[model samples]
Target chain A: MSEKIKILYVDDEPDNLVGFKASLRLDYQVLTAINTQQALSCLNNHQDIKVVFCDQRMPNVTGVEFFEEIRISHPLPVRILITAYTDVESIINAINKGNIFRYVKKPWLESEIIAAIDEANKFYIANSMLFIKNEELQRAYNELNKFAYSVSHDIRAPLSGILGAINFAREIDDVEEMKEMMYLMEKSLKKLDTYIISMHDYYSLQRGELKIADVDFNKLMDELKAIYTVLSKTNNVEFNVTINQNEVFRSDEVPIRLIFNNLLSNAFKYLDKTRDNRSVDVTVEVQKGIATLHVKDTGVGILGSHIGEIFNLFYRANSQEAGSGFGLYNVKSALLKLNGQIEVNSVMHQGTTFKVTIPSI
Target chain B: MKLAFIVIDDSELDCFVSRKIIEHVDKSLNVKTYQNAELAIEIIKDNPIDNSEGLTIILLDLHMPIMNGFQFVEEFEKLPIQKQKKYMIVVLSSTRNANDISRILSYNGVESMLEKPLTLEKLTSLVHRVQQGLN
Candidate 1:
C-alpha cells in the first residue's frame, strides 16, 4: 500500500478524541489535538497533514474560530468542521469564508470521512501539478524572447552585406556584370525569404492558433509538384508523385503545406550537382487509420551525426549549401502541431529519404 | 549649394547603402557616413553645418552597439535650436514593435520613422517630404 494520508482532529472531550483516532488511525495518519491551541501547534509540527477535522463545541474558543486562525497560517490544509444541530450557524459562516472544504456531523460515518479525505487529497495533488507546469511554461516564454532578439541581431548583419553588394552592382554600367550580380542577388533573396518564413512560423506556432481543416492529400501533392515543376526542369531533375490511397485527409492544411514545402524545396536546393541521375520520388500509402508519405531524393545527403539535430533551430547540416537552417525546424514544429511524426534516412554519398505519418481523422 | 546629410549606423554596409541611395536621389547632395552615434554627435556640435546655404538631414539608425537611436535623440535635444533646425532627423530602424514605433514618434524633432534596408522609392519620397517641409 502507498503511504497513508495524514489527518488532524481536534476535540475537547477525551472520549470523543480517542474514539475518532481508534476509528481512523488504521486508514490514516490520525493526529489528535484536545484544544484550539493544540490543533494549531499540531499543524505547525506536521507540515504534510492533508485534512483537519475540528469539533464545534470547545472551551474558550469554537471550532470555527480555530479554523479562521489556521486559514491565516496554513491556508492549504483542507478543513472539515464537526458540528451538532446547535452550531449550524457557525458551520455556515466557516463555509462562506472558504475555511472549510466540507462538514461532518458529531455522529459521523467512518466511510463519509474517508471519502471526503480521498477527494481532498486528489484536489491537492492536481493543484500542485498545475503550479509546476505553469512555472515551466513561464521559463520557456522568457527563453524564446531572448532567442528572438539574438537571432534578429545576427541575421541583420548578413542581410546588410547582401543588400550592399546589390547596390554596388547597380552602380556598374556593364550589362554582363549586372547580370552576374542579379544572379547573386536572387540567391541572397531566397535565403532572406527562408529566414523570414521560419521566423513567421515560429512566432505563429508560439501563439498557438493553428487552424485545422479538411484537406485533399492527392490534390495538395499535385499542386506542390506543379509549383516546383519549372525549378525541377531547369536543374535537369525529374520529380514523381504516387498515392496509393485517394482518401480525403482531415488535418490543419497550413502546417502540412509548410512541412511539405520545406522538405520539397530542400530536395530541389540540395540536388547532386555532378550526378547524371537527378530525381525525387514522393509516395503516400494508408494502412489501417494511419497515412504515411515518403519523400526520397537523389541529393547531397546528411551526415550520420548531424541527422539528430537537423530539426533544431539555426542548425545547418552543410554551411556551404545556401540555407537559413530554419526549414527543417519549421517542418518539425508544424508536424508537432498537427500530431504527426517524421523520420529521416540518409546515406552520406547516396541519398536521403523522409517518411511522414499522420492519423486519418 | 548642395544639401549636407549625415548617416549614422553601426553597419558599414547599411551606411554605404544609405549614402549611395541618398546621393543617387539628389546628385548635388553631400552625404557623410558615421559608424557611431557619438562620432556623429561630436561633428554636429563642434562644427555646425550652414543652415541657410544647405539643409542637413540626419538619418539615424535605431539599433546600434555603442549608442542607440533613442539615446542619440536625447543627446541631440540638448543642442541649440538653430543647429537642430539645420537638420531634420529621420529614424531608420528594422524594429517593427509597436511600442518602439510609438516611442520614436513621441520624440520632439523626429521627422518620421523609416524601415530598412532603405529602398529608392522610400528614400525619394522622404526627401520630397523633407524638402517641402523646409520650403
Candidate 2:
C-alpha cells in the first residue's frame, strides 16, 4: 500500500496501448510501449516494474521473443504474453521454456488483467523476501563458523597452559618456584574465566531485548570504581573517574555496563608494566540528551595497522597478555544496539584512548 | 652433545612451559625463547650457519599474531639450503585445524609437528632422534 504496483504493457497498435493504460491506470502505475524496443527502454528506466505484458504480434519481434530475450537480464519482473488463439502453439512453447509466467487472450477483460497483476505481484514479493533471507542466513552461517573455530582455540589454549604449569609444579620443590607456578595457574584460569564471561555477554547481546531506563552516570561509575579500585590496587595502577551529567540520559543499563566493563578491564589488562606510573582516566559527560565517554589508559597501545581490525571478532592486536579477543567486539556490538559511536586513538607503547558517544532514547 | 633450542610462541605461559620441559630434559642445553615469530626469524637470519658443532632445534608455534608458523617456514625455506639444514624446524602448535596441519607438514623445511605444552617425554624423544641424525 506504500505505492501502486508498477506494470509495463507493450503493444504494436497505439490504440491497444492506450486502452490498456486507461483501464489499469487507477489500479497500477501503468507503463505502455508501442514496441519491444520501447518496452526494453521502459524496463531499463523503471527497474522496479514488477510485471511486464507484451503483445504476441509486432513488427520487429513477437511478445514471446521479447520475453525470452529479457528473461536473461530482467528475470525478476514477471512476464506475460498477450496473444490470439492462432499463437497458442508458440505460447505453449514460451511457457514451457520458462520465459513467460502466463498468457492473456487478446481483447482481454479488466478482471483477467487484474488477476494476473495481483498474482505476479505476490510472486515478486515472495521471491525478493527469499533472496534477502538467503543472504542473511549465509552471513550468519559464516560468522557461526568463525565463532566455533575461535572458541576451540580460546578455550583449549588456556587449558593447555594450566596443564603444562601443573606438570612443572610437581617436579620442582623450591617454594619460590611453587609460588610462581601457582601464579601462572591462576593467570591461566583468569583468562579462561574472562573468555567464558565474554561468551555469555556475546550471547546475551545477540538475543536479549533492550530494556531502556533512566541512566545515572555518577552512580554507575561509583559502582565500577568500587570494583576496579580493588583490581587497580593489585596491579599498582591508578584509576581516575570524572562524571558530569546535567541532563537525564536513558539507555539499556545492561549494555552500558557491558561496554564500560569490557573497555575498563582492557585498560587495566594492557597496562604497560615497564612504565613507572601507569594510569587509566575515565571521563563521562552528558549534555543535550547525549552521553560522551572517554576511557584513556597508559597501556601498551594498539598498532596503527591493527586499529581497523581490532573490533573484528576473535581479533587480537597483541599477545603480550592473556586475552580472549572478545572484549572489544562485545563493546562494539553493545554500542550498536544503543545507537552509539566509538573511536580509538592509539600510539604504540605510549597510550590509547577510546571516545564513545551514545544518544539517549 | 652441545645442542641449542629455540621456542617461538606468542603465549608467554606456553613459552615458559616449553622452556621448563626442555630444561627438565637437559638442564645444560641452551634454550632461547621468543614471544614474536618475526624476532625469532631475525635471529635465524642473523646467524647464517650453525658455527657451533651441534644442530639447533627450533620449536615454532603455528598461531602467532604477525607471522604464523607456516609463514615462518615460507620465509625460512627462502634461505640457502645449507642454512636450512643447520637448524631443524619443529612445529610446536596447539592447532587442531586439519588443513593447517597438512599444509604446514607438506613443507619440506618443516621437520615435524608436536602438540603444545611440550611434554618432557616428547622433548626427550625428539632430542634423541636429533642426536641419532634420524630427523
Candidate 3:
C-alpha cells in the first residue's frame, strides 16, 4: 500500500522480533527492537509510529513500565502489551489505567494482532477529534456568557435612571425645577432608545446568513445622503461621495450598509465645533477584484494612545462624552465575517481616515 | 466652620439634582458641583477653602470616563493625612450589583452607598449620621 502506517514491535528474543517484522513488512513500515534500550531508540528515530507491541517479560523493565516511561516523551503512540500469561495482574493494571491500549496472548494469532492494530488506530483518531471539539465549544460558551452580561448591564442603566427621575418628578412643583427634571428624563429616554437599536444591530449581524448581491454604489450613496441631510444641515456640515468603478462591484448588501452607516454617523457625530468649514469625504474604487473604500473626516479625531483599543467591545475612547461605543466595534466584526479588512489613521486635533477593502469572488 | 459639600458625576443633570438635595438637607451648607471627577480632584487638591471647619461630605458617582470614582479614591489616598481636609466619601450609583457595592464599601474613606435618584430620605439620614458623628 502507498499509504502504509508505521508500527514498532519489541521483544527480548532477537528471533521473535525479526519474525514479527517479516510478517507485517508488506502492510506496514515494521520496526524491531530487542530490549527496552533499543525500543526507546526506535521510538526516538520513528516519531510517527502509530502503534507499538511490547513483550511483557523483558530483561530490566516490564512492558507496563516501558509504556509508562515512553508516555512522558512520546504520548501519541497507541501501545499494546504482549503477555505470556492469560490473565496477568500487571497487564490488567496497564489496560485499566490506559497505559496500554490493548494486549495479545503469548502464541499470537496473525488475525488477533491485525484486529488489535485496526481498533487502536481508530481510537487514537476519535480521542484527538474530541479534544479539538471540546476547545471550540468552550470558546463559544465564554463569548455568549460575556455578551449576555454586558448587554443586560448597559440596557438596564439608562432605564433605572428614567424610573428614578419619574419617581422624583411627582413631588416637585416649581416651574424651573420641573423644566429641568423634564430635560433629564428626555436625555435618559433617548439613551435607552439608542442602546436598544444597537442591540438590534448586534443580533442581526449574528443571526442572518450573508446574501450575495451586485451592490449599486450610486443608489446607496444617494440613500445615505438623503437620510443624513437633515442631520448635516442642522450641524452645518457637508458630505461628499465619489466612486470609480472598474468592475461590477458585488458583496452582501447588509454588511456593506452596516459598515458605512457606522462610519458615516461617527463622522458627523464628532464634527469639530471650532472649524467653520467642516466636511467628510467618502471615495470608492474597484480594480483587480479588490474593492477599496475610504472615509475621511475633519472631525475630532481619536487619541494616539487610544486608537488601538477603539475596536474593543464597549471600549469608550473618550470617557468624558456619552457614546454607546459599539459602532466601530460592530463595524470590525462585520468586516471579519465578510473576509474584509479595515485600517484607521487619526491625529488628535487634525482629522481621521479609515480605509476598507473587500474582495470580489 | 463652613460645611463643604461636593458632588462628582458625569451627568450634568445628575450634578444638578444632587446639589438641590444637599441644600434641602441643610440650607446654609456650601454646595459645589462637578461634571467629572478630574475637575473635582483639581479643586480639592489645588484650592481648599480658607475658613472650612465642619466635616466635608462628597457624593461620588462610580462610572465616569477618564477617572472613575474608585480611581479618584486611590489618587486621593496619596495626599498627606492633613491635606485630606477631613473629607468622607459616599458612593451614589445606579448599579444594583451586590458584588460591586460590597467591594466599593471596602475602600478607606468610603462611608456609605445610596441607590440613585438621590432621595430626600437618604439625604436626611446622612445628615443625622453626620450630626451624630460630630457629637
- Residue A139, model 1: Cα distance from true site in angstroms: 4.2
DockQ of 1: 0.07
lDDT of 3 at B59: 90
lDDT of 3 by residue, A1-361 (tens): 3678788999999889888878888877888888889888899988778899999888889889999888788887899999878548777887898798989988898888889888987876686678689898898788787676666666666655666566566666788997987887788677768767877887788777888888877788788888777778899888788988857777887888889988998888788889988888899887887888999999889988889988877776664445676788889888987889999999877789999998874
lDDT tens per residue, model 1, B30-117:
8999877877888889984564656788999876644678989999999999888777898987776677789988999898888776
Model 2 CA deviation exceeding 4 Å by range: A10-27, A30-47, A57-75, A87-90, A93-99, A168-170, B48-50, B80-82
User: Between the candidate structures 1 and 3, which one is better when assessed by TM-score?
Assistant: 3
Stretches of candidate 3 exceeding 4 Å from the true structure: A1-87, A104-121, B26-35, B48-51
Instruction: Please provide, for model 1 over A224-320, each residue's C-alpha lDDT reduced to its tens digit, 9 standing for 90 to 100.
Output: 9888888889999998888887566677777787888888988988888989999988888866667798999999899898899899776767634
Ranking, DockQ, top scorer first? 2, 3, 1
RMSD of 1: 11.4
Lowest lDDT 10-residue stretch of candidate 1 chain A: A316-325
Worst window of 10 by summed lDDT in candidate 3 chain B:
B47-56
Query: What residue runs in model 1 are displaced by over 4 Å at the alpha carbon?
Result: A1-130, A166-175, A208-213, A246-248, B1-135
Reference contacts recovered by each candidate, as fractions?
Answer: 0.11, 0.51, 0.30
User: What local distance difference test score does each model get?
Assistant: 0.80, 0.88, 0.81
Pairs in steric clash, model 3: none
